[model samples]
Target: MEDAKLTPRKLATRIGVAPKTVERWLADAELLPHARNRVDACRALKVDEDMIWPKAVQERVKTGHDRELAHAYPYRSACPSTVWGELIAGASTDIFFAGYTNYFVWLEQAAFIETLRRKIVSGCRVRFLLGDPDGEVTRQREAIEDVALSVGTRIRISLEHLGRLGPLDGLETRFSSPEDAVNHVSLSVFRFDHDALVTPHLARLVGHDSPLLHLRRQGDSGMFDRFAEHAEELWDRGVPQTP
Candidate 1:
């Protein structure tokens, strides 16, 4: 508020709260406004809600599971592309993408192939776990979605992009095994080192429409590790992508 040059009255007016309410919030450090008011105030102040009320944010984390969750998006597309770009740019050891098609990143992320090349050159292990385009699961998903650009086409498109990279050392691709194809197609997990973006597909809904969870690894037995282990198990059982 000070940096934004907003007075209590102005802030309250902007957030649709009483001026006295704003004054009380200012006077009492422990006082937390309603969630909606906090969001509105953050937007009006051009800052993050946590920046203004770290205590409130901390108090909301009731369990170890809650600690692992960094954020939640109503839809995968609701997450900012910059979040993906930053995670990809920042990871040094591991960059694992375990999405069925793994197609949207090619569209949403800028210069992804070059980014992969750089990551591999830096000794990062970059892996893609995709569903086989010709597999029965892909055919079933295509029929279920009934979209113009089918799931198999999307998987093939991702394969084509990966092929263009021409097999960089430290880069790998695999198709999930037949038995695990259903499980693989239902959940998408993309990991960058200790952080991950996960989406569980709803029946009849496309990947973009699925709810997303942004998780940071907090401990060995947290939600992050659970999802990471799931993807790793599928990868272990997967067949290497054939050129």
Candidate 2:
């Protein structure tokens, strides 16, 4: 206040607050002014808001279990296509699509095969962990969904697209183990390096209809790591696609 040549009354007048309120804010470090008052005071003092109320700024920022969550979509289809394009383009090290069918990328991402080829040629480790089309779990899910485009058909479509890639080095495709089929079918985790898009399939709902969580890695044991670990575990037990 002295540096700004601002008295309690003067600062109060500038921020449109009572002089006693300004005095209270000055008297107690724990007391914080209203957000607007804080911003006005900072401008009047030619300082940053945090320079005056560090605690308030800290309290306003997300720094908990949900800190890693970048976005949430009530339905997977609601998330913008640009987000997927950005994640895929930004990833340089790893791109693991651990969806049960893994068919949507072919439709959603234009020139997806070309993208994968380029990513592989550039040293990215691309992996697809999919469900077995002929497996009993696939049959069961198809019956549950009762859709014209069956679950098994969807898995086959992904396999067909993957087959076209023609066994490039650093690109691997596998079917989740029979025992893990149920769990794999219930959740889809598509990871692009440190960022992940996760979906937990709701009963009787398709993958696109499920809710999605977009997570960015913040720490070793954050939400991103948890989902990444789950995908890795399934991949470890997966059956390699037959040549």
Cα TM-score per model: 0.82, 0.76
Candidate 1 per-residue lDDT, tens place, 1-243, comes to 889999999999999989999999889988888989999999999998788899878887767568889899999999999999999999999999999999999999888999899899989999999998899999999999999999999999999999987587898999999999999999999999999999999999999999999999988888999999999999999999753
Relative to the true structure, candidate 2 reaches a TM of 0.76
- Candidate 2 per-residue lDDT, tens place, 186-216, comes to 9999999999999999999999999999998
RMSD (Cα, Å) of model 1 = 4.5
* Candidate 1 segments exceeding 4 Å error: 1-57, 60-63
Candidate 2 clashing pairs, residues 3+ apart or interchain: none
- True lDDT of residue 191, candidate 1: 99
Highest-lDDT candidate: 1
Whole-structure CA lDDT of model 1: 0.93
User: Which candidate number would show the highest TM-score if scored against the true structure?
Assistant: 1
